[model samples]
Target: MTTSRPFADIDTWVFDLDNTLYPHHVNLWQQVDVRIGEFVGAFLKISAEEARVIQKDYYRRYGTTMRGMMTEHGVLADDYLAYVHQIDHSPLQPNPAMGAAIARLPGRKLILTNGSTDHADKVLQRLGISAHFEAVFDIIAAELEPKPAPRTYQKFLDLHQVDPTKAAMFEDLARNLVVPHQLGMTTVLVVPDGSKEVVREDWELEGRGAAHVDHVTDDLTGFLQGLSKAS
Candidate 1:
């Protein structure tokens, strides 16, 4: 494989937990999606179909459904987080290849996720890569502020004492990379393999501000493996 110099000089490696670490084909988010709709339906006393529309609306309007629920319906953030993350983690099997690649990186590794720590822990444990990370900074750690929010990024950097210039953030969402890029961290967008069509949803599409993205990779394992080989 051809090697690249994308990750050079990075001392702190930050990763987003969902589709970034695992392949999108696993479809773990589909379960979470159903649960979110259920939670909303139950909470709002509305039908599931109606709740689904509201769920997507909240996700678009507030950056997260939990934020919108809390703001509009006085729902507890933890309640929503716990309820939605209760799915089985069997889809994510042990990935020693990814573990080995990450282990070779010369830096502190951390997972910064919009999901709760419980969910992050389960995913990491299932992947057999839990020991490699120094910490998992979840939504609660960000005071329920989700990513793409500049303050959350600053909080992650401050709490972890990571130098943005020496840090690199890997995320599946293009919009989330913008603040990291502006903060001097190398930003990598992890898109799904064989994504040829224009992404239809506003939230699903890559940001036009993708100039902030320093690099884009579809295969995170291979990308990280290349970094390992270069080192």
Candidate 2:
């Protein structure tokens, strides 16, 4: 909940690659979940269903299922990423409207994602908008530090030479955006249509402090349009 308008002057736009760029209802995560279950089953010598339960537990405890698997089960990161991303991407179609919106945005645009660079490349290629971003900061760039961690955000800004004051973070996850807000960067929550259930507004508000939310919009294009008008 922001009291005042914070979109007065923004020079750089940092975007999250996954659900933020595209709608989650597209069911890409379902594929990833299936892969995770399969990997867990094979690694732990358990049923897929049991593996699913263990995967959830790991995610809850270690922030990521892979992290838990690495620490507890001694799984390799490369193997995990390879198995998880082995899915059909034909369902993803090009979002020309999104591409147009990215083209209209003012200043540098970069992607900051917890996913792998190869996956990011595949998604961008599928969306037909790889040219929209100047650079992409994926999981490799973060050095395995996932979102909601202050250090990850700090490292991202440091690596990209981004000024917190001039940059805005556009993410679908409220927790991830919370850190950038704390660092004096404007935060925009991209809530796609029909995906309101996934956006945890209450959790975001609960943690709101110096790093407060600035805007919440259902459509990224409309939000950027409003910013253009405000500017």
Candidate 3:
């Protein structure tokens, strides 16, 4: 259905964690979001309402609340990562089909996330696809810099030695794919199935743009399956 070849000549595959790897219907991020609000409230001694407002604001402004907190409030990155990612990851089911598809892909596969390595590990393990990844370039690995920040992508490439032209990046947020597309990586926007509200912001919803994204899919497992077959 996509005009561009989805996996054509892609030697390296980069993926965002969180909502991209797993279905957003699981609402795993809601747990983390609630915890982030709690952390913000407790740290700032603010009301729940105020904390919620700041949480979304920071997310929009800084690409992540942790980055905002660190820059503005002098919060420690490790402490924030530890506290915010302390939710139960049991809601995600084992997805061997996805694991198999990823396994069939050529060359290297990596996880690039705003989340911590521990959280990424748990999610990948729960999905039974942890072994498929060459490495996870987490927020900490990027020195607390999150995606949508062009510097983080350059760091990821430098550390992994990945060629942008021959790689593909898969992400849930359309905005996150912009820098990757600009860097010549094939960009795929993974959205939720039959969901009108895929993201909270207009910018996130604009991922289907031809300028940045080459493909869009609702079912990540099925998408990977198609890629495996085509490969």
Which residue segments of model 2 deviate by more than 4 Å? Answer: 1-5, 195-211
Give the alpha-carbon lDDT of every model.
0.87, 0.79, 0.89
- Between candidates 1 and 3, the one scoring higher on TM-score is 3
Worst 10 residues of 3 by lDDT: 196-205
Q: Which candidate is the best by lDDT?
A: 3
| Candidates ranked by lDDT | 3, 1, 2
For candidate 1, the 10 contiguous residues with the lowest summed lDDT are 194-203
Cand. 1 TM to true fold: 0.93
Residue pairs in clash, model 2 = 181-211, 182-211
* Displacement of the residue 36 alpha carbon in candidate 3, Å: 0.4
Q: After superposition, how far is residue 41 of candidate 1 from its true place, in Å?
A: 1.1
Colliding residue pairs in candidate 3: none
Give Cα distance to truth, residue 90, candidate 1, Å.
0.5
Q: After superposition, how far is residue 67 of candidate 2 from its true place, in Å?
A: 1.8
Regions of model 1 farther than 4 Å from truth:
1-5, 195-202
Which 10-residue window in model 2 sums to the lowest lDDT? Answer: 199-208
Rank order by TM-score, top first? 3, 1, 2
Tens digit of per-residue lDDT, candidate 1, span 151-173: 99999999999999999899988
Highest TM-score against the true fold, candidate: 3
TM-score, per-candidate, Cα-based? 0.93, 0.87, 0.95
